[model samples]
Target: MNKKQSGIIVTLVVLIVIAGYLATKVNGPLYVNDSDFNEKTAISLKEGKSSSTFFTEATLSRDQDNAKTLQNIKALIDDANTPKEQKATAADEYLAVATATQNESDIELALKAQGFDAALCSIVDDKVEIFVKSSKKELSKEELRGIQDVVMSKTKLEKIDVKIKE
Candidate 1:
């Protein structure tokens, strides 16, 4: 590959790796200071601390970020300077990211449809981190199992965590 092709490939790989590391763990001591956690905010919905506004904002931010990234990838794919191989690879990665984004939304909606007050689903590589809100402070065994069933049916990811809020 030419220098330009190699550079583009490297950049795409790095972005994919970083995206997968975004997160899904909410069980930890609350960090009042913003610097204590990743700026992405989606990294951990703060377990029991998430309010409806926070949940809405987090999902909105995540989707906006994905849209921006997808736009950049599309530019690369359309660039005349991009090699054929690079374009093909970029297209595949673009599709993967887009599909994952849609899957996350779908999972959330399905969970809500199942009767949860609010739901957030994060798909990080082979794992999925889910947080659901309800009036009850504790989730029953059946409730937890039902959440898992919704996710499993929607996605085949290996590790799924239905985090117990707080």
Candidate 2:
């Protein structure tokens, strides 16, 4: 092949590789699954901790996802091409998301402080969901009530759901 044609081919190959890499990075898994939580809990227990600590692998993965989402919103808000009205809307959403993320962190800490092995909380559309990791794979009524009370007190949200996982 001619040198010019060879050069063009190389450039196209480079661009394709770059596009693929960017797509994978942006489209990566955004949330952890049940198995991830279970594996993290098992590892935590094997490490000799009586109770799992805050910020397990699953929790960290969640935090990373939240951070990326917030960052994207901020970028949209700052983009000059975005309409003023859209920017305003994005700003409001950013504030709400930031607040909810902070509340989730606080709730998780409160659950841990209350002697739970590990906990994760998420707020969506005014509803709160909590996932607590327990070695026993089950929680008593009182335990569930206590978690609900803590969540209510912390977030002041009427809709709260708690799940215990082993």
lDDT of 1: 0.79
Leading candidate by TM-score: 1
lDDT of 1 by residue, 1-166 (tens): 8999999999999998776555323344322333554755444445455578657776876876787788889989989999999999999999989888989999999988988778888888889999787767788999888888887888877688886432
Against the true structure, what is each candidate's TM-score? 0.67, 0.63
Q: What is residue 32's positional error in candidate 1, in angstroms?
A: 31
Error of 2 at 6 (Å): 46
Q: Which stretches of candidate 2 lie over 4 Å from their true place?
A: 1-55
lDDT of 2: 0.79
**Window of ten residues with lowest summed lDDT in model 2:** 43-52
Q: Per-residue lDDT tens digits of candidate 2, residues 13-93?
A: 999999988987899755334465554344332334333344375566677668877888998997999999999999999
For each candidate in turn, give its C-alpha RMSD to the true structure in angstroms: 15.1, 10.0
State the C-alpha lDDT per candidate: 0.79, 0.79
**Candidate 2 similarity to native, TM-score:** 0.63
